[model samples]
Target: MGRTKRKRLKKYEQNSINLCYEEHLVSLQKWMSNKGWKNHKKLSLKLFPETGRGISSKITVGANEVLLSIPMNIMITYTTVKLDIPVKNIFTIHESLALFLIKEKEKGINSYWRDYINSLPEKLPPLTWLANEEEIESFPSDIKLNVEYTTTNFKNFLNKIRDFIPNNSTLADSLLKWAYVMVNTRAVYVDPHIICEESSLNLLKDEPSMALCPFLDMFNHNYLSNTEVSIINEGRCLFYELRTLSSCKKYEQIFISYGNHDNVKLLTEYGFFLPDNCYDNIKFTLDEVLKILKFNLDNNKYKFIKEHDLHNNLYIGYDGVSYNLKAVLFIGWCGVINRLDSIIFSSNYPSLFLEKKLPDLIKGLLVIKKNEFTNDLRQIMSGRIVTESAQMVLEFVKFRIDFISEVILEYR
Candidate 1:
C-alpha cells in the first residue's frame, strides 16, 4: 500500500491563512527589533496546508544564504531566567523555564513577551488535553505510554513549584501544561562551545543546554530539508540553506531538519505527525513480544537476555522484522542455538533465522494492530462532534498501519 500524501494549499487558501497571522508577525517583528535581532526580510510566515504554520521565502534565496539571526538576549534560556532573578533556584532547567513562562503569562499586557505569548496556541492538544476516560483509552499502547510519561512529569513539576507562586491555586493547570508543551516543541539545542567569549560567562555555566528561538521556531520540520541551523557566528544563531532552493518557487515552504526523528518522537514532542513519514515504524517492547510468542521467560535463554541487556533493544521497522525479534524467536522455537551464538548471529546475520512463515505470522499480528488503529478512526469519524486534533491522532495511527502493511507486502 502506498502512503497518503499531504494536499497542497490553493493560492486562495494561502492568502487567507497569511492574513490570519499578519497581525502576529507585525507584533513579533517589533519584538525582534527591540532585542537587536536581524530579520532576513526575504522570509515570511505562511500557513502550509499540510503542516499548519511554516516559514516561506518572500524572494529567491541563494545557496548558503543566512535566513535569520537571533541575538542571544532574545532567546528564552536558563540564563534568561537567571538574569531576571538573582536568587539561586532549586528547580531543574525545564521546571524553572516553565515557571518563567507562567510568570510572563501572569503579567498579561505588561509582559515584554506579550506579543509572542499571545501568538501561542490557546489550546495544546496533546494527550494531556484528553479529559474523558474513553478518549484516553482509545489511544494505542505507545501513545498511551508517552502520555502517561509526560503527565507524570507535569504533576511532579506542579508539586515542586506549587508553593512558589502567590495564590498558586489560581493558576490553571492547563496554562502551565500549555507552556510546558510550547517549550518542548520549540526549544533548540544550543551547544556550549558556540557561546561567544565576550558575553557574561556566569549565566552560560548555569544555563540549560536548550533555548527557545523566537522567529526561528516557526520553521516547520521536513526530514529531507536542506537547511541547517548553527550558533557559531558571533553570539547569535543563524539558519541557512545548504543547497540552492532552485526547485522551490516563490513563497514555497522551506523547512529545517529537526534531526531525522521518527513519527513517534515528532508526535510526542511536537503534537503533530508527518504524513507517510519515511522514518515510520512499529515499536514493540520485549514483554509485549514475549506475550505474543507465549514464551515462558523463566528459562536460561531469558536469563542470558537479561544478563546482556538485549531484551530492551527490539522493534519492527518498515523494512522487515528487527534482529532482536529473530534472536528471541530462534531461542524460543529452535533451541539448538545457544544464547551467545544466537545473540552473535542475530547481531551479525539475522537473515539466517528468517523462516518462510515468519512474515505471514507478522502480517497476522500487524493486521490485528491495524484493526485497532482503524477502529479508533471509525469511532472519531462517526462522532456527532469530533475535534480536528482528535482526527489527527487517527490519521497518524492509520499512517503507521499503512506503512506496516507495505512492509508486509514486500516480504510476501
Candidate 2:
C-alpha cells in the first residue's frame, strides 16, 4: 500500500476542519516567547485539510535544520508537577499527569500552562475506550475484545484515584478520560532520568518517561516523516530540539512521526488511522490459525512449532506472508522433515513443493479476514454506531477488505 491520495476539501469542510484557535495560538506564542522559546521564522500554525492542525513551513526548510527547539521548562512532566507523596509512590507517569492536568484545568487563568491547555480540545476524537454499548457492538470481535479490556482497565484506574476528584463535579470521570487521552496521544518521549527526581523515581510503580510539549504536539504524525528529536543541554540551559531529516517546501505541513504503527494500533490509541499504512499486518493468534486450519496437527509438528516460537508471528501484509506463517503451514503440508532447521530457515524452502500449496493455504485465511471486514463494515454502516471516530474505523475496515482482496488477487 502507498499514501492515500486525498481529494481537496470543499470550502465548508476546510473551515470546519481548521478549528478556530487563533486566540489560543497567539497567547501560547506570547507566553512561550517569554520562556526562551523562539519558533523557527518560517514556521506557523496551520489547519491542513488532510491532517488537521499542524505546523506549516512558510518557506522551504532544508534537511538537518531545526524545526522546533522547545525548552524543557515549558513542558509539563513529572519534573514540572509537584507530585504528592501518595501519587509519587503509587501512580505511573501518565496517572500522575492526568491527575495534575485535571487540577490545572480547574485553574482557568492561574495555571502557568494556561494558554497551552486552552489550545487543546475539551475532548479528542471518539476513542475506543469511550465507546458506549451501541458503538462497541459494531466493532469486529478482535477490536471489541480489546475495547472491552481497555475500558475495564481504565475504569479500574479511575477508581483508584477517585479521591483526588471533586465530589460535586459532574464531568469528573469524562474530564479524567479526556486527560488520559491527552497524555497518551500527545505526550512525547523523554529520558526518565531527565524528568523524574532521583529520590522518587524508584518509588514509582511503573517506568513512564514522557513530557507534554506545547507547540511540538501540534505537529501531527506521519509514518513517512523523517524527523529526529533530542535534548540539547548547555551549561545553564536545556532545549528539546527536533531536527528535520527531510526538506519541506513552502506552505507544506511538516510532520514528525510518533513511530511506525499500523491502522489497528493507531485506531485503538488515537481514534484515527492512517490510510494505506505500510506497517499494517493482518495478525492472527494461535487459536485463530488453528480455527482457520480446522485440522489436527500431529504432536511432533505441534511441539516443534511451540518449541521454536513459530506460532507468535502469524501474519501477512503488503510484502507477503510472514516467515512464521509460511513455516507453520509448511509443517502441515510436509510428511517428513529430514532436517528441521533447513526446512524452516532455508532460503531454498520457498522453491520446494510447499510453495505450490502456500497460496491455497493463505487464500482461505484471506477470505475469512475479508469476510470479517465486510461484516464489520456492514454493521458500522447501519448508522447505529454514530461518531466521527467510528467513521474513521469504518473507513479503515473498508480499506482493509479492498487491500486483502488485492493481496488475494496477487497470490492467485
Candidate 3:
C-alpha cells in the first residue's frame, strides 16, 4: 500500500511539472506577439532548448538581452493550522487560478476579469481540514479573499501595459514600469539571491531602464543580476542573467548596491581608523594639551590621527598594547576633560581595544590607582580574557560614561 501511494504521488508531481511547462510556453508566445515581434519561428529557435526543465528563457530585443527563470516547485508551508484535506488542494486552487488568467489574456477576452472576481466564492472550498471548528474560525479569511482580488488586480495591470505599448512607447521603458508595478503591488515577490558578473556594464544611471525577458519574469528573482553586453552603435546595455538554484529567504542580511566596488569602498572607509605614527613624546604645555584634548573630545575628533613632524614614526604603549599613545591620549584626555557625549574611538584594532583593554583602563581611571589598573590591564595583553573579550568591550563602553563625567568635573 505504501509503495502504491508513493507511485501515485510521483505521477502527480510529474503531471504538475508538465502543466507548468506548457502554460509557460503559451504565455511566452503571447507576450512575444504582443510586443510586435514578427519572426516567431526564428526567434523561437534562438531561445529554444531551455537550460533546464524549470521555467527559464532568454530574450533579446534589438541589442538588449535578458535571461529569466522561475522556481515553480517552491513549497510554502503554513504551520499554524492543519487541515484534514491535503495541502495540495490549496496549491491546486492557486495554480489553476494563475493558469486561467494567462489563458483569458491570450484569448483577448476582457470579460474574464469580472468572471474571475465573481467566481472566487464557488472556487475555494471551506477549511474542513482544520482539527476543530475554532481553528477554522481563527484562520485568516481575508488572506483567501485577497488571493482572488490580486488576480483581478494583475489582469488590470496587464491591460494597462497593452494599452501603453500601442502608444509608441519604447519597449524597455514599458518593461521597466511593469517590473516596478509588479514589485510595488506585491502580486509577486522577487527572490533576493543575486550573482553579479565582475565584467558587467555600469547600468546605474540617473533615470531607470530595464529590459524584460519572459523566462526571468516567471521566477520573481529579487536580486536582478545585471550583465553588461556591448552592441554595435548602441554602446552597452545591462542584461538579466539566468537564475540559480539557491534560495534567498535563508539569509538574514541582504545588501543591494549599484556596483560591487563602490559598496566595498563605502564599508571600509567608514570603518577605518587613523594610523599610530602621528603622535610621540611631544611636550605639550599642560594647559595646551588640556585645551587640545577638550576641543577634540567636544567634536568627537579623537579618532582622527593627524601626522605631526615632531612625532614622526614614533609609537607608544597604552594599557600594555602598542598604539600611538600620544594620539590616543590626546583624543581620550580631551574627551575626559570636556565631558563630551558619545566619544567615537577609531582604531585599526577596534575589536581589540573594545574587548580587551578599554574596560580595565576606564575602571582604573575612575579609581585613580596605577598598580590595580596595571594588574588588570596585564590580563588583556597576555590573552587570558580572550573568550570574554567582546562582552568586556560592550561593558566598557557602558561604564566609561560615568568616568568621563567625573574627570570633567575634577578638571573644572
Candidate 4:
C-alpha cells in the first residue's frame, strides 16, 4: 500500500479543487511548460474569493525556497520590443514595453506572448485623471493635483506616439492606457548593467530597471510580504529568481512586497489598498501643514526645514506623527536656532519646549482632513458610482475617513 504518496495527494487535492480553469491561464500554464519555467512543483494559479487570481502552493513551502525562477529569454524587455520606428530612442523602457504589448496584440494569433497578454486585465481600474469634474471633486487635494499632472504627461506621450497609432484613433487612448498600466503595475526590476546593453538603455530618460516577467507578476502584493528577488547569470545563461523570506503552509495565497508604499500611493499607483495596511499613513506637504494649522514660517525657517530635508516625508501613521513632521512643527514654532540638530534628532528635545498645543494642532489637522474626505465621499456616492475607478476612490475615501477618525479619537 502506497500510503505515503496517497496521503500527500489527498492533501493536495483538497486545495487543488479551486484551481483556475480560465482559458488564458490554461494556455499560460502550457506555455510555461514549453518555455521550461523552473518553479516549485506544487505552485499553481488559484482563484481565491478574496484576492482574485493569485499564486498558491499545494504543499508547505519553507523560508528561502525558490518560488519561481524565470529564464531571461522569456522575460519581456526593451530589446524584446519590435516597432518600425526608433521606439527605444523616443520612449522609456516602460513605454517601450507597453508599446510592445500594443503591437503584439495587433498581430492577433501571430502575436508572441499572446497567452501572457491575454492574462492581463483588459483595462486597469480608471484613475483620477479619468474622473469627471464632479468625480474629481471627491479626490484628496494632493491626489487631485497629481491627477492633473499625470493627465498632461499622458497627453504628451500620446502626441509623441500619434504616428504609430492606426487611423490616428482616439480608441487607442484606452488601449494605450491599458498597456501602460499593465506594465506599470506588474513590471519587475532587473539590473540593466549586467543584463542589458547600457547604450540602448541610455536613450530613455528614466532608469532601465523595468522588465515584464511572465508568471512572476502573478504573485499579488502585500506590504508585509518579505521576498527576495535576484538575477542569476551563468556566462551565456541568465535567470530571474524570486524566493520567499517567510514559510507558508499548504493552500495559502503567496504575496510579494511592492515596496513600503502608503495607502495613498498604493491607491494612486495600483488602484488598490489594504484596509489594515501597516504602511497606511496620512501625508502632508509643508504648505498643507501650515494651511491646516494656520501657521507661518519665515524664509529662514523654511530654508532650515528644506536644508535638513525635514519638509519631506511628513506624515501621520498608526504610530502617530512622524519624526519629520514633529521636527517641522517644532521648527515652525520655535524658529531655526543654534543646536537645532540636537533638538531635531532627539524626540524629547521638542517636547521640553512645546506644550499640548502641538498635539492639539495635529488633531485639528486630522479633523479637518477627515471632514474633507467625508465631503468627497458625499460627492462621489451622490450618483450610482458606476465606474470601477470611482468605486476604488470611494473605498479609499471611506478608509481615510475611518483612519483619520480613529487617529483624532485616540490623539487625546
Candidate 5:
C-alpha cells in the first residue's frame, strides 16, 4: 500500500479564510466605540490569520466620514505578546489601548510604527529655494558645507571597523561605531538644510518641511517600503509606516505548535537567538534608548560646558536640557541625510559641528570601547576656541581619558 498523504491547507489560504466572523467584529467594534472611536463605519473586513509574511487583518473604519485603515497582526512568540497596530492610532485612538489588550505586554512601542507613520507624508520642496540672500547670509558659513568621503578615507574606516568586529561584535555595534566617527571627524558633512523647517526655508529658498528618515538610520524592517515619507507643510507633523512581529515566546510557541520543528534547527544553525521574534524587540529597545538620550539632550538637563573665552580659559556652561544647540545640530544632520531639500543652514559656523556631533560621537565611542576595545590608539581634534579654547580642549581631553581609562580597566 502507498504511504498515506495527510491533507493540509496552505498558510495563506488558511489565513484568508480565518476571519473571526461577525461575532468578533462586533466585539471589536464595541471595543473601538468604547475607546471613543465614534461614527465608526466598517469599510471592509479582511483577514489573513496565518502566521507568515504579510499575514494580517485590515479593518477600515470610517469616523465622521474620515476613513482610517487599521491593520493588525497577531503574532505568537515565546518571550513576548506582539500586536502590530497603526501609528495613527497611537495619536488618534490611545497609546495605552494596545498595552492593555495585549497580555504580558513588552515595555515599549514598536519602532516600526514610528517609521511607518513617518514614511506616509508627501515630498515637499527642497530647502535651497526657500531663503533670501540677506536672511541666508546671516547664518553661519564657516563650517565646511559639502565634505565628501574620499575612497581612501572610506576604506580606512571600513578596515578599522573590520579589525574591531573580529572580537565578536554584532552588526549594530559596528554600525554605531562607524556613525560616531563619520559625524564627528567631519568625514561627512551633515547638510544643515535637511535639519529643520526654518533653516530649510531660509537656506534653500523653499517652503519649510520636515526631513525624510534615512534607510540606514532606520534599521527597523516594518517601515512601509514604498512610501514617499516626508514632513507636513507646516513642518510640525511627520509621518511614516511600521510593521511589527510576534514576541519571542509567542513566536516559538506558534512555530512549535504548528509543527515547524525545522525552523528551530535552522535558527540554531545560523547562530540566531532561538526565539527569532525577539529581534524586533531588541531593535525597538535600542531606538527607544537613543530617542530618550536625544530627548534628554534637547531638554537641556544634559549639560555641556562650553569654553567662551579660549585665551582666558573662561568657560560658560550650556545646559542641554533647557537649550538646544546640540539637539538642533543633530536634527539638522539627520534631516540632511533624509534628503530634505527644503532645509538649509545659513551660517557657515564650524562650531555647529562641534556642538551637534561631538557629544553623541563620544557616547557611541564609549559604548564601542566598552564592548570591543583592542588598544587602538585614537585621537580627536577640536576647532580652536580663542576665548576658552584651552579650557575646552582640556575638559574634552580629560573626559575622553577618563572614559577610556575606565573602560580599559573594567575590561582588564
Candidate 6:
C-alpha cells in the first residue's frame, strides 16, 4: 500500500511537469500579454533538472538588460483588493490578499487570473502539513516551536476574518491557509505610497506596502544570485534582471537572491533550506545550558547573571562557536567553582575565560547538541522518503552537528 502511494505520487509529479510544458507556460504567456505585461519577450519559463520551474533565456541575456518590466496596473496589490473584493474590513494587508486569492481561486477558469492561479500548487509542503504530531515534534525544538507558532497564528487569523465573508462564499481553512502562505512567501516589498495619489490605494490606510508579481515570483532563490529588483517611474513600475548575465549561456536558468537569509528563516518562511548555508548558526539558550549543568546555581549567581544579561550568548557559526558563548560559560563555571568575584569577573574577562576548564565545558555543550541532532537524523532517515522540505531541514541539522563535531575535535 505504501509502495502504491509512492508510485501514485511519482506519477502525479510527472503529470504536473508535463502539464507545465504542454499548457501552463504557453497559457501563462498568453494571459500575461492579455493583461498587458511588457518587456518579457526574451524570457521563457522552463523546468530544469533538480531545480523546478524558473525563467530562462533563449538568446544570451546581456548584463543590465531588464528581463521583466511589469506595469503597476497589473500587479496584485492593496488597490486591487480594495476594488474587487467585498470583504468589509481587513485587519491586515496579508489577510486582504489571501481573501482575494481564495475568492479568485474558487472561480476556476472564470477568474481572469485563472492561468496564473492554476500554476500554483494546490497546497504548499510547509511543515504545517506534517500529519503526525510526533513527526512535527521530532524536529529541533526551534523549528518545532516556529511551526506551531505560525500554524496557531494562521488559524487565529482565519477565524478572525472568516465572519466577514458572506455565507455564500466558499472558505476552506486549508485553502485559506495555503493562500496566506502563498502571499507571505512570494510577495515582494514595494512602497505603493510613491505612486501618484490619484492611482494609489487610499482606502487601505494601514495596509503594508507589498505586491505580488507574476513570472518574477517564479524565480528560485540563490543566495549568490546577481539579479536586482528595483522600482522605477516614480514607484509605479517594477523591473528585475540579472546584473551579470552577460556570462550566462543560452537556456541557462536565471536566479534572484531572496535575501541574506539563514536556513532556519528559509525553512520556516519559504518551505526550503540551504545545505551548508554560510549563514547557518546553531543556537544555545541559557535555559537549556542551565538544565544540563550538574550543579545548581545559587539565587545570587542566577540573579547577577540575569541582571547583567549573561544568558543566551552561545551560537555556532561557520567559524565554529562564538567567543561570547565561551565567556558566558566560563563565567558560569567560575560561579560553580566559587571563584566569581563580582568586580574581578567584570574586568577583562576574555583572557580569564580561556582557562583549561572552559574548553571542556564548551565541548560538553556541543556534544549534547550533536547527539540530539544525530538522533533526529536517524529517525528522519529511517522514515519513508521525507521529501525536499523535510530533507532540507534534516540536512541542515546534520550540517550543524558535523560542524559542532569538528569543533569538539579541535579541543582534542
By TM-score, the best candidate is: 2
Write the number of the candidate with greater lDDT, choosing between 1 and 5: 1
lDDT of 5 by residue, 105-209 (tens): 122245322322222112211121122333223212210021112223334444543553254244343333333222221111122334333422232222222
Candidate 2, position 270, lDDT? 80
**Candidate of highest lDDT:** 2
Q: How close is candidate 4 to the true structure, as a TM-score?
A: 0.88
User: What TM-score does model 6 achieve against the real structure?
Assistant: 0.75
Estimate, for each residue in 232-344, the C-alpha lDDT of model 4 and write its tens digit.
87666778888888887778778888888887777777778887777777888888888888778877777878998998989887777888998887876675477777767
Better of 1 and 3 by TM-score: 1
Stretches of candidate 5 off by over 4 Å are 1-15, 22-25, 38-412
Clashing pairs in 2: none
The CA-based lDDT of model 4 is what? 0.75
Error of 5 at 36 (Å): 3.8
Tens digit of per-residue lDDT, candidate 1, span 355-407: 55466556655666666667766764555425554555677777776766666
lDDT of each: 0.64, 0.76, 0.28, 0.75, 0.26, 0.65
**lDDT, candidate 6, 34-76, per-residue tens:** 7667544467666665556766666776777666777656677
Per-candidate Cα RMSD to the true structure, in Å, reads: 4.6, 3.5, 22.4, 6.8, 26.1, 7.7
Q: What is the model-wide C-alpha lDDT for candidate 5?
A: 0.26
Worst lDDT 10-window in candidate 6? 1-10
Residue 330's lDDT in candidate 6: 59
lDDT for model 3: 0.28
Better of 1 and 3 by lDDT: 1
